[model samples]
Target: MNYIKKTDAYDIYIEPSRKTIVIRQKWKYIWSVASGLPNWSYLEKKAWHQKADNVIWLQWGSHFVFWALVHDENNSNVSLHKKEFNLEFDIQWVTTDQHWTANVKKIGASEDFGSKVNPSDKKIYLAHTDVKRRIVSNINQNTVKHEFGHTIAVNDEYGKLNGNYYDPIYVNDTKALMNVGNELRARYIRDIKIKVNKMIPGVTFATFLDK
Candidate 1:
């Protein structure tokens, strides 16, 4: 539960008019040392997002999760996926040895719903593999962006479903990316811009939001 330091630079940039934003990210797939590395391409493909303008690009050496997993010589109390930008996995074969299961889990207190976002910390935790799989299958999909929505302080519209208090505006709007669908609505974009503006001052999102 790392809080976002006021001094920390914003990790996201938004352009409300064009409805696009860029999120900086890093990733790591932790497997048993016995398990050889999985194909990076397959992982990348699964994690690819199909959104037309939104992007979540990987930034090397910046994935705190990967670093903690690899460097936990003492196996210290490392909270996976529950902390900032951390995604942890335990490798397992699916149908065959060649096939790998992307089993993801959260390492902290249980919530009425699933997944969480700490805007101050700029982190999104996908609590279940089903959610993670969906996200990896299409990284730029609404689910991924929905979590990104949390990183920017966007409140959840759906209540129990996503572990937050209910909000009618998001729940009734299926097209709203922050709710429970794949479409990215204009309102969500505008909401995000407003939130980002308040969270991070003195930054201009390239005219990407204008279009």
Candidate 2:
């Protein structure tokens, strides 16, 4: 079997100022105002999960809406790492939790399922309608990145460390950031391809939904 060699990867840079906005907007979109403030660390660990949600949302609304991200300041501390990875964006730097109910109310989702008033039992909960439609109606690209990344984890047999490897290594193959390594790489083009293949069967490497 031939391994999918990384291709068409490009460096991504977010001015420190814009990075914060992107993260916040994405969180706002994903968690929704109804979901209230999100845990930053939780977002860091599993941000890619937001992608499927965003795609679903786009399918439903087909409009770009503003999203605001709030962090729980009581326990918020994210690092600013060099975006040396192949990915063009980083959602790890956003961490602030000001209880803002207005945003959630604006979307008519105030009494919705994930409101702070009634947080979901699941760590990450998607609206059933959105799931049924195979779309995420209110989240953004970054949120999708955060949430989908969570699904790629597997425990190590030796119990050494929490190896959050997205791309698992094969026999005698070196670990790649797109595969199983700590650092995010500049290879999200490959990452997205992998996710799309899983989410929509029969998708080829070159196929992508129109933006």
TM-score: which candidate is best?
1
Span of 10 residues, lowest total lDDT, candidate 2: 98-107
Error of 2 at 141 (Å): 24
Residues 1-211 of candidate 1: C-alpha lDDT, one tens digit per residue = 2212122323343323223333333322222211243433545434432220123222111121211122243433333212223221111223332221222342233332344555554334443322332433223343444665554346776555525476765567654556665554434345334444453233322112111
For candidate 1, the lDDT comes to: 0.35
Model 2 TM-score (2 dp): 0.19
RMSD of 2: 19.9
RMSD of each: 16.6, 19.9
Error of 1 at 20 (Å): 9.3
RMSD of 1: 16.6
Clashes (backbone N, CA, C under 3 Å), per candidate, total: 11, 34
Query: What lDDT would each prediction earn against the true structure?
Result: 0.35, 0.27
